[model samples]
Target: MARESFKIFYAGRNDVILYEGVEEVLESLKQKYVLGVITNGNADTKKIGIDHYFDFNISASDINAGKPEPIIFEEALRQSGFRAEEICHVGDHPVNDVEGSSDFGMKSIWFNEKELDWPLDQKPNFKEVNSWSELERTVESF
Candidate 1:
């Protein structure tokens, strides 16, 4: 009963809250590049009402691997049909998103909305953006 109830409640992802400027940023970026989502969570862009902006959505659950793992990144590269160096991954996690994509040979942009200092010992090979407004510029600079 609990499992079913949970599934029912989460069916539409109605509780998913996007940060400010998410739509605007997505709209802007969509105009210039091929947009896709690579997520470890069950965020359905369609359910979240943003599916039209993305060309594809790759989920960790679908492939039995998560970020920081090469498999997930590999899957994204395969789906994108773009060379690793030609792609740029934007995410908030210092290790999983930033380091993972960078190590996979893709350009990375750290969405540091909280302005937190980087927690890793190694210097970041990725660029950092604190606001959605900064995102497009950062990605373009890559």
Candidate 2:
């Protein structure tokens, strides 16, 4: 899992902090980047106020082909005028996030919030991150 790759800080904590600075961040990257999200989750990211974070969103409800299929990710790329190699995907699930993204030549970051152990068949081209703060740092540094 996560601890195997990224450094884990804490054991378990679920403190949610919605980004109030989302608008600023989006505005900063809006023109230079093509922002979109492809997720297998059921929630509508737009309705949840994350719409500003991404220019487009492809959810399980929107795509019949779910994670591991590459359809959702492909759809997002197609809509965003991006090539797979230039795209970056972040997800906690190894198969869904890493494998799916990697299969399509997109770089992935394993968002391993839960510190666990897992052996991969191939070296995933990613950096595993443990917490949202770590994730934020990674994103900001990008």
Candidate 3:
């Protein structure tokens, strides 16, 4: 469904972790700075008109590596032509989103909208926000 020309997809492979505000957050960031998405799925970036908003995307389905592995993030930063330090990666996964972003010195902010308890083994040093408004404020202050 994603590979065909002119086809658009909203989500893929049941990746429920990416919820509503992702697009909103990205749109807000796009107004202040460059934004993008990097993942291990085949979800079409253009389905919701985010393809132009983001400069690039690195997906595990297109590469040999995935999240929690710094290479994928590295590839994303490289493809976007933006240094990792200049961007912040946000997501619901504790290990992949928080740890992976921090491992390479890129900023990380966990989207804790689900109210799950923080992981003991995976405590993050980066910012954590539960709502998109809070996330906007947090990012602005950074």
Best-performing candidate as measured by lDDT: 1
lDDT of 3 by residue, 1-142 (tens): 4465323333443334556676687677788876667887677666545687777777787889999898888887778788888878888788888888888888889988888888857566788889876888888766
Give lDDT tens digits, candidate 2, residues 68-102.
78678778788888888888777888888888888
Judge candidate 2 at residue 111 and give its lDDT. 77
Best to worst by lDDT, what's the order?
A: 1, 3, 2
Residue 67 local lDDT, model 3: 94
Best by TM-score: 1
Residue 30 CA displacement from its true place in model 2, Å: 6.0
Candidate 3: list runs displaced more than 4 Å. 1-25
- The pairs that clash in candidate 3 are none
lDDT by residue (tens digit), candidate 1, 1-142: 9999889877855557888988999999999998889988886788788999998899899999999899999988888899899999999999899999999999999999899998989966889999998998889997
Give per-model TM-scores: 0.92, 0.71, 0.78
